[model samples]
Target: MADPVPALVATGVAHTFGETRALDGVSLTVGARERVALLGRNGSGKTTLLRVASTQLRPDAGRVEVAGADVVGQPDVVRRHLGVVFQSPALDPALTAREALRLQAALVRIDRAEVAGRVADALADAGLADRAGDRVGTFSGGMVRRLDLARGLLHRPTLALLDEPTTGLDVLARDAFWAALDRRRADGAQVVATHAMDEAARCDRVVIVDAGRVVADGTPDALTSALGPDALWLDTDDADALAATLRGEGHDARAVVDRVLVVSPSARDLVAPFYARPDVRALSIQPPTLADVFAAVVGGRGGR
Candidate 1:
């Protein structure tokens, strides 16, 4: 078989705001029908990168392509193939969900006859069919977010860009959004920018951005494995003393809390020895999580 073309591609993309560089040589690619999560802290250029990818902002350097069209040179073509859900809710308060979809269809130049069918399909896909006639103002934050998603999908673009799409949603709403996204990904590509580690874990691939650069990129499992070793959480009366003892024995151990010790890989094999000690109270071993890998790569606690 021949090489597969990317649904979305960015190369050496950079953006600057006066004295500040919003993005520094950022590059990424999402294969056709692939789901990729873009992760970063606030002001880490996640939004800027999304804007460039969506053709809303031009990059100062480098290139962006959506569905094989250059974003800057062929923005109209890119727009035809790209759907974007902005960070802020953009629906008109007075418009009903159905009306909003109709308006969006018109803006995208869909045929009037096809608009209604597309609206119904999109609303049903988003689980908002029952509330289609309700004014957007009456919808809860989660509902409005779903409506925004439905509107983005009205045109059936091949590439969907979501910027913090789950923001403000409770657990149930967030799961619903993820399920909707899962359905979309089954048919096309999705590029999601989020600060939530749990959400990032759902993507097929994750790109961790920090200080305007791609610090790490891989499948969640690969990223976590790269961090090396399972972390053992140990609860003891003397966390500091235990940590010191483990470190003296050339083991990596640190006090993560008052009575909790985060033990390193080498220390895990020797945990049985510690467990045998009379002073050891409780111990739990777990595979490194995405959060742990994120903290290791970014050199700090994972984003809230």
Candidate 2:
């Protein structure tokens, strides 16, 4: 049987703002029930790619498809299946949560009879049902973020295009917000573009971008594991001495200031003896982290 259609797909997407290239031949796919985080630092093309994918900005070159329809060719149909929540404050402060959702439903051309029920469902999904009657200006940042998410649900989109959707939320609130997103996993796909590493860690997979290109893509654990070996960190003023001794003992060591570190494939087996050394003031074993993996893959390159 043929492979099932992906929930979202983009190929050879290229975009530029005047002379500056914002995206360079980017491609990605997210299947149904999968969540992919677009991980990148500021100005790394995350937002630009998201805009193209969401049909907010047409790309200079590329193809984008959401839920089986081409974005450029079928904008109206694509827009119906996609819910976009950008980082900016898109809601009207003067309008109540109910009013904003109602307006959104009207704008999206939802059946007039279903508007109230959809608004109620979205409010409950975002945990904003109680505050639906209150003006959005009175809501907290987290509440506003949630309401923004609720508004996106007005049409029950099949793909959620979120650019830093959790920006202003606290840890607890962010977790709660993700839990809300978790509930939607079974319906379709979620693509989150974010600079926050921890937030990206919450997704099912990560796609790191740098210099207008996609640098890496994998599950957080898979990427971390693929970095190879555990790290042994030694803290002491005698870093040079420690390196010398470790090298003498058949261990590769790199001395940086007061710390000596070694990336050893056999670190787990060899680390037990280092604790008994007199010159080793401190010894710590660090398993490969996603940050370390990300740094290795995308750090130290100049901006685009």
Candidate 3:
């Protein structure tokens, strides 16, 4: 049988803003019911790609399809099968929880007869049923985020796009949000843009992007396993310099943020020499992480 259609597809998508190239020839596909994370640091074009897929911003080149509908040519049809949870809270404090959901149902053009039932179900699903009549101003940050998600999914879209949904959420709030999302998105494909390494690790697949290009794509374990069994992190004053020195000596070393990482099957054996350097303040060895994998991909592409 032929392969099933993917929930989302972006082919050679490019978008620019003035002089900034937010997305450049980026292509990705999210399978049915798959949870994929667009992993990248800030300014890496993950969000830009999400906007294009959502039809909020048309690409300067190429095209995006959501559930078989072109985002630019058939935006209304694409929107019907797509839900978006933005990083920013788009709720009004004066409105009650029920009121907010009711408004969302209207915006999505749900049947007027079904609006009431859907709103109640959404409030209950978000764990805000008891607060349905309460004004949004009284809700906590977590509650607001959950409500936003409920609103986005009110129409039961086939694809959900989440843009750093837990950007400013606290540990407990983030956990709660994930728990709620887990229960709701069981049957749909999800494409979430996030900078959190831990969050990317939780997804079924991770697509690492840098400078508006995809550097790597794979399952979390598959990606990290490629770096070997263990990783040695050398905390140094000048990580770039240390990484250069280690690389010159024929080691798989790369600078990752504030640390220089060296990966191998036996990282313990490689630690002694680096630990003795005056600039190396501390050193630790652990299993390879998504961050380490990301750094390796970016480094191979000639980036820090």
TM-score of each: 0.84, 0.83, 0.91
lDDT of each: 0.83, 0.84, 0.88
Candidate 2 positional error at 187, Å: 2.3
Q: After superposition, how far is residue 272 of candidate 3 from its true place, in Å?
A: 3.3
Clash number for every model? 0, 0, 0
Error of 2 at 244 (Å): 17
How do the residues 221-280 of candidate 2 rate in per-residue lDDT, one tens digit apiece?
888777556866777768888888888988767675567776577888766678777888
Which candidate number maximizes lDDT? 3
Model 1 steric clash total: 0
Top-TM-score candidate index: 3
List the candidate 2 regions with Cα displacement exceeding 4 Å.
1-3, 232-264, 268-284
| Cα misplacement distance, residue 18 of candidate 3 (Å) | 1.3
For candidate 3, what is the TM-score?
A: 0.91
Candidate 3 whole-model C-alpha lDDT, 0 to 1: 0.88
Error of 2 at 259 (Å): 9.8
Among residues 3 or more apart in sequence or in different chains, the pairs in candidate 1 whose N, CA or C atoms overlap within 3 Å are none
What is candidate 3's lDDT per residue for 183-247, written digit by digit as tens? 87675898889989988988999999888988899999999999888878889888889889888
